[model samples]
Target: MSKILVLGAAGKIARHAIHQFLGQEGVILTLYLRKSGRLQKLAGDSVEVIEGDVTDTRHLQEVARGQDVVYANLAGDNIEEQAKSVVEALEAAGVGRLIWISTLGIYDEVPGAFGRWNHEMLDDGYLEPYSAAAKVIESSKLDYTIVRPAWLTDKDEVDYELTQKGEPFKGTEVSRQSVADLVVKLAQDPTRDVRASVGINKPGTDGDKPSWY
Candidate 1:
């Protein structure tokens, strides 16, 4: 059985991941969120729901104890600090596997006209911190997979592709479900993309910018 803890469990992507993970047998799940009411409906008998801030190392360590993998679907202006806190808590708990959801432009991995547009759209507000968070995750000895996804959509589709680190990131948009699917796969195995940063998006969706942007 795989033991997993999901941080930022109230977010859209994490919510989807929770639903996906519920379908698996022999997978034990713990959900960490600021408020438990939002995801309470999905808790079922298979999940343990806890309410707490991810930045609180004490709270994080409490929930992360005995977990084999930590999946984070978090976003914020202080995301770097949160990431650092998570790393600290994981280290304290002696847990080593982490799967973090970041964004594509963090590494300027997006190319051509789309890259320029994405940068202009996000400015430094999102890029700087997310980039810093990635650095923190990589700097730690934890077995980590940093997932950078292109502009996310609410579409229910699951089709997506991965752009490995050092490769130009592809596509402009991908579904939230697609990102969740990848997280589920990593959580199940926890060894597929250890210490690797991956970029995800739908193929052929690249353009000057995401259609909605």
Candidate 2:
């Protein structure tokens, strides 16, 4: 069985991912959270929980050791530092696969009027860190798939499409459920491979006018 470590496991997206992975085949999940108290809702022997800050290299290394794949959902003002810590820990632990979640505007790939507003909302300060973090992952020797979702929504539906490192997909929002589904799919398939980034969003939605806008 493949052992997977999920950083920022208390997050909304990670919660959904956990729901999807549980009871699935050939995989066991270990959730890493800064505060184990926040993970009370997920308490169960079936799931392993590790409490630690992502910026702490030693803690990250301990959690990542012997894991086959890692899914990073961490976010904050010091996101780049967190990414650096995880990358270093993964390298030291010899863990190869990583699935990193970042926002679409990080690369200015968002299109249309709303996309413009999205960039304004993110500003350069908020995105600069993620961009820097992505550069680190892109240059690393580890196999990785970086997923940039257009905008996040709490919608329960899973209808979505992906734009793979080509044209940016047009849509303002994607549900947490859909993103979780994609992560689970990626975790199961080694064929997803290294150093690739893709954009994800719901289909049949207008680029200029998203529901949230």
Candidate 3:
């Protein structure tokens, strides 16, 4: 069975990914979050939920042990610290595969007016720490795929496309479900996109800004 540990499991995207992971065969998930009771109803044969802070490296290491993949869907002002804790914990636990959710513009790869707008919106306190966090994950020896998603929407559609690191980010936004789909795909195949940072967005949605903005 594919034993997966999902950090920040209560996150919106992680919740979606959890459901998708359960839909697959031979996949067992351990959901790690600060409040286990939030996902208590999901605990059962194929799922296990635990309450633990990812910043607690020792505790995280214990939970990560024996897992084939670690999917992190985390965010906040102290995101870099969280990334450090996750890397340290994964290294100590000897788990090498990681799938991290990050946002677009971390690399200044989003071009033109839209890129400018993105910076204007995210620069205050969001982008800097996220960029630092991505650097932490990239510097680690773990086989990691950093997924940078475009402006996210609540749209339920799954249409999306990908762009690798160094390529210009496409479109202005993508559905949250599309990002969740990509996370599940990476979890299912560890060898795909190792050590790569990818940008995901919906095709034809390119604009100076997301449609909703």
Candidate 4:
């Protein structure tokens, strides 16, 4: 059985990831949230919820210990600090696999008119923190997959594309469900071993590239 730790368990995409993990065999999920009250709906006899801040090393280590994979879905101004805490704790515990959720414009992958808006709207003091967080994860020895998803929508669709590292970012927007599905797929198929950073977005959408080219 694989023991997985999901940080930022209260997030929009994290909710979908939790849904996907349900009923999967050999998998025990531990959801980490800042406040247990926020995740009241996520709890059951099978799911374990841990309350702790990611920036606290002691709390992070306690939650990360004994987990085989850690899925980080955290977002915020202090994201870099939180990521550093997660990386350090995982290293101390000898956990190997890390699946990090990042935004599309973090790598200048957004294109065209909407891309410009993304930059104007989101690219500020927040991005440098995310960049620093990514650096720490990339430098770690653990097997990692950094998933940078395009503009997120609440649509329930699963149609999207996945591009490998160094490839141009595709699509203008992607559903949170699709991102969750890909994360679950990566968890099941270790052979993919997509170590480098990759981008995910919908196909045939405006201001985006197709998933298959």
Candidate 5:
């Protein structure tokens, strides 16, 4: 059984991931969110709900105990700090597997007009913190796979592709379901993409920006 702790459990992508794990054999979910009330019903019988902020090291470590995998789906200006706190808590708890969510532009992996448009659209507020968080996770001793997705959409489709850290990132928009499916894959098999930062997007969606933009 995989004991998975999902930080930012109430988040869009995280919600999709939670649903993906439901009814699956040997999968137990711990939903950790600042406001978990909204997610209580979603937890069902296979989930343990914890209400708290990801930046709280004490709470993070407490919940992180015995977790086979830690998946963080967090955002905000303090994302760098939040990622640092998670890494520290996991280290303190001796947990080694982490599936961290990041954005495609965090590593300047996008190219051409898309790259320019992605940066201009996100600016520093989004790019800076996310990139900073990715750096923290990459340098950690933990076995981590940082999954960077392109512009996310509310669409439910699961079509997606992988772009290695050094490879040029593709696509302009991908469904939240697509990103969550990757998380499910990584968490189910800890050794799948260890110590790598990968980019994900729907194949053939590449353009100046996402279709919605």
Candidate 6:
């Protein structure tokens, strides 16, 4: 069985990924979140629910033991610290693969007017730390894929496409479901995109800003 540990399990994308994982056979999940009660209902045959902070390296190391993969769906001003903790914990636990959710423009790879708009919206306090966190993951020896998603939406569909690190980010918005789908695919095939950063977006949605903006 493939054992997966999901950090920040209470998050929307993580929840969607968890559901997709549960639909597959030969997969087991350990859902780790700050508030265990939020995902208590998921505890069952193929799932384990645990309360923990990803920033607590010792606790995260203990929780990460024996897992095949760690999917981090986390955010906050302290995200860089959390990334460091995750790397330390995974190395200590001997876990070799990680899937991290980040945002577009962390690499300044968005182009045209949209790029400037993205920086304006995220530059104040968000993008810098996220970029730092991505750096932490990239510098580690562990196999990692940092997923930088375009503006997020709650739409139920899963139509999305991928862009590599150096390529300009495409489109303006993608559904949470699409991000979750990519997460699930990476977990299922550990060798798919090792040590690479991927950008995800809905095709044909390109604009100066997301539609809602």
Query: TM-score of each candidate?
Result: 0.97, 0.94, 0.99, 0.91, 0.97, 0.99
lDDT of 3 by residue, 21-131 (tens): 989999999999999999999999999999999999999999999999999999889999999999999999999999999999999999999999999999999999999
Model 1 agreement with the true structure over 1-213: per-residue lDDT tens digits: 888899989899998998888888988899888888887776766798888899998889878989999999888999999999999999999999999999998888788999999989887587988899999999998999999988889997999999898999999999999999999999878669999999999998979998886
The residue-by-residue lDDT of candidate 2 on 46-140, one tens digit each, is 67887889889987898899998999998998888888898999999999999999878777777678777887788868988998899888888
Q: What is the C-alpha RMSD of each candidate to the true structure, in Å?
A: 1.0, 1.5, 0.6, 3.4, 1.1, 0.6
lDDT of every predicted structure (CA atoms): 0.91, 0.85, 0.95, 0.82, 0.90, 0.96
Count backbone clashes in candidate 3. Answer: 0
Candidate 1 regions with alpha-carbon error over 4 angstroms: none
Per-residue accuracy of model 6 over 32-78 as CA lDDT, tens digit each: 99999999998999999999899889999999999999999999999
Error (Å) of candidate 6 at residue 141 is 0.6
The candidate that wins on lDDT is 6
Candidate 5 lDDT, tens digit per residue, 86-200? 9999999999999999888887888999999988988858898888899999989999999998888888688999999999999898899999999999998878999999899
RMSD of 5: 1.1
**TM-score for predicted model 5 compared with the true structure:** 0.97
Model 3 vs truth, CA RMSD: 0.6
Q: lDDT ranking from best to worst? A: 6, 3, 1, 5, 2, 4
Off by over 4 Å in 2: 41-43
User: What C-alpha lDDT, on a 0 to 100 scale, does residue 1 get in candidate 6?
Assistant: 89
Worst 10 residues of 5 by lDDT: 38-47
For model 4, the local distance difference test gives 0.82
